[model samples]
Target: MQVLLRGDWRQRLRLISGLILFAFATTHFLNHALALFDLQAMYEVQQWRWIVTRSWPGTIILAAALVTHIVLALDKLSDRATLRLPAWEFIQLALGLAIPFLLLPHIVNTRFARDIFGVNDTYLYELARLWPDSAVLQSTLLLLVWIHGCMGIHFWLRLYAPYRKFQPLLLLIAIAIPIAALGGFMVGGRAVAQMIADPKTFDEVKQLSHWPSPDNADRLAAMRLIVRLVFAAMLTAALGLLVWPAIQRRYWPHFIINYVGAGSANCTFGPTLLEISRMNGIPHASVCGGRARCSTCRVRVEEGIDAVPPATFPEAVTLASIGAPQNVRLACQVRPRGPMTVTRLLRPSTASPADVDEAERGSEGIEKPLAAFVLDLRDFTRLSQKKMPHDIVFMLNEVFAAAGSAIAVHDGWIDKFIGDGLLAVFGEKHGIEIGCRQALRAARDIDLALDHINAKMEAEFGRPLRVGIGIEAGPLLMGRIGYGPNVDMTVIGSAVNVASRLEAVAKEKGAQVVISHEVARLAGWTPAPELLSKVDIRGVSEPLEIVAIPRGRDLPASLLASIEDVDERVVGRAAF
Candidate 1:
């Protein structure tokens, strides 16, 4: 049973019901808005209700929807403790529960008794029972129902960007509609009472009880039973929708992979994975639905790479942003198109797969020296703001793609992308000398890649693209952090910060690439005479020597010669 709930179709059904309930509330509000007009307008609402109620299908639908919504809500409530809910959310839940209970008596008194049993009571008869004496309870129930519904709509609309802009207006409308309708109902009640006191005006209230009288007791009982059964089914479905996924977690515990095509994979049945993990007492992160929207469920396909399907649309979008390799896929999206083997790259939620994979491969040795490189796009903020959203996305995609490919080709691992910049780490398991050499070579490769990207963009957009890069060498701590399902692999220390600062200096000096004196020393290379300079970096008290490569130029022996003279003077100054 739990397994059935975890299935995608069941979840989809629940989503559809939720949408239906939202629609019902919207239309109900619109009907109540009629109160802003006159008593005749309120009468017209009753006529509309009569039309809907008389229709067999409409009656069945409404009954079922109400029952389903209540059941699902109650099921969710049972899953979590009341004490765990925030005070406001708990209050809302209480109000929602009260709505059906309070509404049941009123519905029976007005619609059911009159329409089904030939009670022949006017609208005024029901209004008089609740006015003034029962006013507080009536008003409270109305307010609770309205507020609960409006809040649900608010939450739903928040999920989409287009609706966000009109949120304030939507809220105002939600509040105002209920207030006006309740006020009008109260005023109409008073008007009806006044008319009843006078025999001459009694005839005016006669038409208010216009519902056709039922023919027999048997027919009436059948109608009532049908209504109850319909509502019961709807309520059961809603409750099942909310509760089944949890039940699945308790029972089903195996990971099932479905294959789609060649070189592509998706992580379907992740809820089952989560459930199995929990049953075996293994930790997993799925704060949201196990959807590919969040990259928390990332994994690396270790074997059968050729049998996996290409990335689906959502998976591709997220992977492209993070610069994930072809072999890496989010566990939520990698549905196996054919037979495949995969390892959970992200052992924990917070950790990136690349770092975890590296650690598992025994690439993190104590003696291994790493070189860090940072590449920042110059004038990205101003440029991005001036371009259209799609254009900005396209440009960033091209830049990151080229930069990431170049780093990977040179045997480097990208640590992170910092806004409009890229941070690549080299030699997590290699010697200091080799790390520095690879870092320098990667820098040159990135510069060349950018040139290719710029040429392509120049032809398309009639403008050149620009970026600045910096490289530095130093010892660092590298490992994984976090417990169980939420772990992350990253490097930390002063060396990382210095490398980032060097990138900043490169941007300020109008250079495409900058190398710190330490990196140059490790490389055993002299900078060109005109390519070396000293610049004061923020957070550093003294100026440091830097070798700059101008934009649209290739690194050469002359540039290395200038770096040597600049390095000598800076080292002497530091010694003094």
Candidate 2:
């Protein structure tokens, strides 16, 4: 058997249980859709529902998921340091707890009423009761459950590229399902109402409304009372959890926690710095939610540093890796033993590229594998020597605009601009193969786009501009570099170095686009090569065999197409 630690097991449990619940909801909604046909069709579908859901295997899974999910939720609440949460998160929590309350009566009257009281459970019966209530409760229940589940799914799968790509389609489906289900109910209810109103069908419709015996009514009343009492007890337990935090705050030693700079808040100890920041409506950044996975929430203890708690092992490791100073402590991990002044290190403003006040703020540095494309103007440096600075700047912007558009169409992004060239990366958000293909696509587009730029600039400069691109694939560190206002996204590794060196050698090799063997192999690219030669690249212990294209526009017609149809191969190349 495979062994799992505490965190692993808990995550697995939550994921498995959540999936089971979601499956049940999906089947339930599909059954609701059958009502649009007629009562007979709906009840027939309900039989299938019972076969799948009430069967021993399905019943065990459903019951286990319900218990496990609740236990985990309560466990998380009990262990929580503060009541602070993002609005969506808080809403999801509230909706999750209220679901059983709103659904319990409906469940009892349908399933239990049928099984125990000999009452018929059918689409007409449910819609007849629901139609009179204007479907207010049913609609509310459906919307609440759907919204909560969607939010959970988004949080779970947003990191995966496929999920993010299909999110729009998923959202449309989410919206349409409930609308169709509820609309079908309304339609079916109207049809039944019309039938009942006709004098000929009036008695038959009345007979369909099966009434429970007096004994059954008494039992139902007692069951409802028990449900209410149990629900009340659950609410009481949750209340106790909330009150316990306050009780501890009152009795425990008190210390004032101060937030400095923007989004400031003041709160008492009996909570972590992250706790006070979130609970007091301060926008603190905790990507891992105070899990010590990152140093994002680190605060510089400007004064009374010693008064703060010492660094835990996780905090120390994270801080050291990011070169944090001795005075800096992770806000999430720190629990002040005495009054301490601190500031949130990471805010949404710092994380955003569009913030007006902090527009220059760059993303934190992280290492990742990326496809690097370094393209250099063949003669722009020499051309700029004779031209005015503003003219050169304008010309370069025109060139970049064309090249940038080409890269963008294929999901590539410019990391930085060199003096007469640009460094771009692909697969920052996509997989490795896609990134390589994107680089090739960009190469072709860039060559074609240069003609447009040259057409605009030739009259002023008396010459056409040409560019050489080198595409290489390898492991690399990508992140915003530099301190203060000098920060910009940069790629650093053999991939970038090799691509840059290749650009430097393009003119000598009589090529406009050069690709490392590694890139060609990974992208499943194979063009009938004019020549394949081992060439010495800078910073490489061994010379690399590279494939050269005389011009980007002259790339093989099947370059991108082959990436999809061709099987993968291995062709290693040395670095720059």
Candidate number of the best lDDT: 2
lDDT of 2 by residue, 76-117 (tens): 666566767766567877887777676666667777787787
Model 1 score (lDDT): 0.61
Residue 234 in model 2: lDDT: 72
**Which pairs clash (backbone N, Cα, C closer than 3 Å) in model 2?**
538-576
Per-residue lDDT of candidate 1, residues 83-116 (tens digit): 2333345576677766765565555655577766
Please list the Cα RMSD from the true structure of every candidate, rounded to 1 decimal place. Answer: 18.3, 7.5
TM per candidate: 0.43, 0.67
The CA lDDT at 485 in model 1 is: 34
State, as a TM-score between 0 and 1, how close model 1 is to the true structure: 0.43
Model 2, residue 258: C-alpha shift (Å): 10
